[model samples]
Each structure stands twice: as structure tokens, then as C-alpha cells.
Target: MRRGAGIGAIRNREMVQAKYKEKGAEMAETQMATLSRQLAQLRTSLESFAAKHGTKIKNDPEFRGQFQAMCSSIGVDPIAYSRGCWSEALGLGEFYYHLGVRIIEVCMTNQKRTGGILPLNELVAQLNATKSSYASEISTDDVQRSIKKLRCLGTGFMLIHLAGGRTLVQSVPGEMSMDKTSVLGLAETHSGQTTMSLCCQEFGWSEDRARTALNQLVQEGMSWVDDADPTGERVYWFPSLFQAVRSSG
Candidate 1:
């Protein structure tokens, strides 16, 4: 009788465990269903929003940047698959893809002068000046979006943030040394040009140390030497910084 009781207790325990497992599975399924519904609702709302502001988002750089930010917040890539629900709704995918192509052309065209690194605004300006059918509508945001797509082509397009709120689009594959980067930052702070004396005064570096870093940048074609300074001091002008100055002027 004791043996039979023990067997019955084991059966009861197994039954309870099986029931709990089944309940957990059902709960998981229900949660998944709720999440799916939420996602569907989000997509529908996003599509409606995109459709409503499609033109403004496409033609205006500021508006487009804001829209991209919104899409990013929701984990939506409007241009992810070229042509899909989001693209069909907003027509942004085709716009950015074409812009991406034009960006490659511009980068290749100016590679000699800029060494695959140029001011983001200047790049946009050149792209708009290309007289391409969509050139008139191109903006900095558009250029940035297109460059994001160009990463797939292994083109090494990247955005660099320099001092003084300057941005550059880099299409080359190279790492800037710390000293070079610091020099660029210093130049950015000084209207895109840095004199050895300024560097020495600011960083307390010896004349030789300051000259070596600035000279390295000039050697890499990343900076231009300006011996025409009224102060009779050679100044290193970072091209991207110069580009920013020109645009602002």
C-alpha cells in the first residue's frame, strides 16, 4: 500500500509540473501576440506620418533630419530595404539611393583635391551644383543619408566631428593620429588656421613638438601651409576647417 502511495505522489508531482509548463507557454504566446499588435500599430502610424510629410521631408534638410531622428527613435529604418512599406510610403529610399550614387561620383571627382575628406556642407554644395535632376533638392541631411548607404559598397564613407561644430565627410580609410587630431582641433578653434606660437602657448608644447604635428598634417595633404600670414608666422590651415569657414562666410 505504501509503494502504491509513493507512486501516486510521484504522478501528482509530474502532473503539476506539466500543467505549470503549459501555462508558461500560453503566457509567452499571449505576450508575443500583444507585442506583434503593438508593432503593427507602430508601423501603420509611421507610414501615415511619412505619407503626410513626404515632400517637406524630402525637400527640406532640417525637416528631413528631424524626420530621420523620429524614425530612429522608433527603431525603424525607412531606407533599410530600398523598396518596402516605409519606402513606398515616404519615397525616401529611392531619393537617398540616387543621392548615394551621386555622392560617389562627387567623391571620386574631388578625391584629388580633398583626399576623400571634405566639409559636409561643401560636399552637399558640390552635389547640388552637379546639375543632376535631383540636385536642386539635395541637402546636408540627404548627403549624410546617402553616405550611410554607401557603406555597403565598402567605400569607407564616414562622418567626422571636428571642433567648433564642424562636420566632415570622410571617404578614405585612415586613422588620424592623436597629435594630428589635436592639431586639427586647435586649428578649428582658431578660424581653421594655427600658428606654431599659438599651439605652443595653448598646449605648452615646445616649438619642435608643435611644428612636427602641424607639419605631419601638411605632409598628408590634410592641411595647407599659409606663409602669407601678416604675422610672418606660417599657419597650418585644415582644409575641412577652412571649408567650414568659407561656408559660414
Candidate 2:
């Protein structure tokens, strides 16, 4: 009787273990399915964004190369990166479309010169007219948000004050041009090394300041540092900086 009871208990334990194993497998499968769906949604969004922008973002070499490098470093597929670029371009295109419509209206009404550029006041009036048509769409708040987004993507406009009370809004080209010195400093400090703190100590900067500058450079595509240091130190380098150094010599 004792042996029979013991055998029954052993079989019950085995059954419980098998049930737990099946549940674990089901959970893993469900998680994978969820991830797959999310990725699909992201891809769709990216493609839609690109489609809205026309061909400018798709064909821009500098933009494409920087985007590809960043995406590759972070393990994003090349196709996905292309889609993201398109999406970003589409957003900018929408703003430009509105602006272009206003410009055409202003040019037709005020200026007899077809090819010659108009003055700053005329441009501002056109922009204002455009803003008025889509007042709900082009509020001050929206402009601020758009500017922030553009800055993140390394594109922005600067208001330059010219002679005789004129202001011109010009596009700032290339991330490197805007932040060259700081980017070079970061690349120099982190080249072939990791851990901004160690670099900071070697270069006589506070750890916090060094980290901030280094992170900014990394975001701007001038340098890169690994997130993890299982090997006891971080590593950093800038491919562009290396090329520049080689070319100069």
C-alpha cells in the first residue's frame, strides 16, 4: 500500500511540471507575436511619412548616409531606416507645402519681377498669410514643436538680421557645420577609448560636463560610445573624424 501511494505522488509531480513547461512556452510565443505586430506598425508609419515628403528625403545623399550609419549602429534594418527618413521628410514637406502656397500668393499680388527675389517683409507677409489659412494647424505652439523635431534630425532654420531692419530665415545645412568645434572636441577625447569619466580625467574636464558633450556628439553622428562595458571600459570613436584627420595629413 505504501509503495503504491508513493508512486501516485511521483506521477502527480511529473504532471504539474509538464503543465508549467507548456505555459512558459505559450507565454514566450505570445510575446514574440506582440513584438512582430509592433514592428509591422512602425514600418507602416515610416513608409507613410516618406511618401508624404516626395523625393527630396529619399534622394538626399548626406541625409541618407547619416541616417543609415545611425540605424546600422543600433541594429535597425536598412529598409526600416529608409522608411523612417521618408516619414520625417513628409512632415517637413507638409510645412513647406503650406509655405510655398503662401509665397506664390504674395509673389503674384505684390511683385512685378518674376525671377528676382522678394524682400524680407514680403516673405513674412506670405508666411503670415499661410499661417492664417491654417491657423489651427500652424500655431506658435506647433511651430515650437516642429522646430524641436527638426533640431533632433539636424535640420533647422536660423533668423538672420540683415542691414536695414530686414530678417532672413535661412536653412542651416549639415549638423557638422552648426556644432563643429564641440563635435571635434568630443571625437578627439573619445577616439579609441570609452568611459567619458576616464576621458574627462585625462583631459581635465568634470565627468558630468564630459558626458554631456560626448552624448551630444554621439547624437549628432560625430562619435559613438557603447552603452555597456562588460569588459570594464567603454569604447568610442568617430569615423568621420578619422577620415578628416587622414585627409588633412
| Winner by lDDT | 1
Question: Global lDDT of each model?
Answer: 0.77, 0.48
Best of the candidates, TM-score: 1
lDDT of 1 at 249: 80
- The 10-residue segment of model 1 with minimum total lDDT is 81-90
List per-candidate RMSD values in Å.
4.9, 18.5
Off by over 4 Å in 2: 59-62, 69-249
lDDT of 2: 0.48
Task: Show where candidate 1 strays beyond 4 Å.
Answer: 1-32, 51-56, 60-63, 82-84, 131-136, 195-197, 204-216, 225-234, 243-249
Residue-pair clashes per prediction, in order, are 0, 5
- For model 2, which pairs clash? 49-86, 49-87, 50-86, 50-87, 194-234
Candidate 1: tens digits of C-alpha lDDT, residues 1-249: 999999999999999999999999999999999998998798778788787877777677788888888778768878774544466666777777778877878877876676566878788888777755853467777777788778767778877776657677777766666676677778777777888898889889899998888877776677788898898888777766766677688
Q: TM-scores of all models? A: 0.70, 0.31
Candidate 2, residues 22-81, lDDT tens digits: the string is 999999999999988987676665456446634544344345445444444545544323
